[model samples]
Target: MEDLRGAFAIVTGAAQGLGYAIARAYAQEGMRLALMDVQAERLAQVADELNAQGGDALPLVVDLADAADTERAAAQALAHFGTPRVLVHNAAILINRPFSELTLADWQREVNVILQAAFLLTKAVWPLMVTAGRGSLVYVSSMSGIKGFVNESAYCTAKHGLEGFMKCMALEGRPHNIAANTITPGMYMHTPMSERNYPDELKQKWVDPMLLTPAFVFLARQDATGVTGERLNAWELSTNPPA
Candidate 1:
């Protein structure tokens, strides 16, 4: 495997959950990091942890839903650690209400936070990737994007839209050596969100968080060249990953 030492990377929603795990994985590999989240307090602690471990890390606290906020996040990240060689759009908001009960604001907020945020971040980073001639954007989409579920209309819609956006980005970005892909993780264990919503009665279905870090490292590696527009599942890859 190629060494990621000195490579700069960005992981959105890095204050907790899968995003935190992703940051740890990258830091272990010696990647300089720019971690973004809306939770300012949590972001501080995460940064301290990474820095204590001798990883170069910068934490940005901003609401990702606003276009200007996302723009600033991208700018601040680049300013702090130079341009990121890898960008992971792992932040998402889930609305678990019945279709009939969902409001316009609920739908719009989900779309703005999930899809628009990714677009803004990608657009901000594209010029840098073009200059460097190498970059990758990974979207942490959901299985809901592929298959529907009840009471998650807004979440499903945003995730499905991400697929289409990623495909187009992959096609256009390939010429600039900027690849785009998505990862749909199975039910994750011990994330902040999971801890909040998962009940003891439903613990049987939760997937181990440790199993996810490897695939992330692999996908973001230099050897992952030409692997654009692909959607990978962590569970499927654990047993029979693509070569």
Candidate 2:
């Protein structure tokens, strides 16, 4: 485990699912948090839970699709938490529609949430991280980012774009003691989104998220040196039962 006692962090899409899990992991290690999302009620609930665990967590609700809104949201995070040492771009949207039936707006919106939002958030915090001379930026990508998936053209394109974007950021940010890495998590069980897509029978056979939080903590810590522009898979990393 890496020492992160004084670090401050920000997690987007933190209302539920992967975002919430990431935030909780940081909180457990005593990292102050800025949780941003569109879901006010659930976002607040997450914040409260972190606070209950004796973690400092701030909630900021904003629509990432709007450029100005995303920029403003980042500003809010900085104002509330000072310069964050860790930034996780975990918010994303998926439109599961066949290529022939997908609309132009659907494609645009999907890309906007993943690619544009990451750009805006990173840009907003760039100066702060530069001034601190140390920071970590983690992008929550998917297997789709590295490969293709049915009914996932828009999502896949946007996630693949993140790989390129994060690599470039890693190169530029490295000179400033900042690292950027992307994690391409495979399908997992038990998230708000999963409640909609996963059946009860399938949940038992999927990867449990608890097993992956440690990697997230490592990435956000100082010990993750020289680990930039890399992609990780949770299921593969956690397969220890002779699978």
Backbone clash numbers for all candidates listed: 0, 0
Off by over 4 Å in 2: 198-202, 235-243
Cα lDDT for residue 132, candidate 1? 87
Highest TM-score: give the candidate number: 1
Q: Considering every candidate listed, which one attains the maximal lDDT?
A: 1
Q: Once model 2 is optimally superposed onto the true structure by TM-score, how far is the C-alpha of residue 78 displaced, in angstroms?
A: 0.4
Error of 2 at 231 (Å): 1.0
TM-score of each: 0.93, 0.91
Rate residue 217 of model 1 by lDDT. 77
Candidate 2: C-alpha lDDT:
0.83
Worst 10 residues of 2 by lDDT: 234-243
Q: Which ten residues in a row have the lowest lDDT in candidate 1?
A: 218-227
Give lDDT tens digits, candidate 2, residues 12-72.
Answer: 9999888888888889889999999999999999999989978899999998888999999
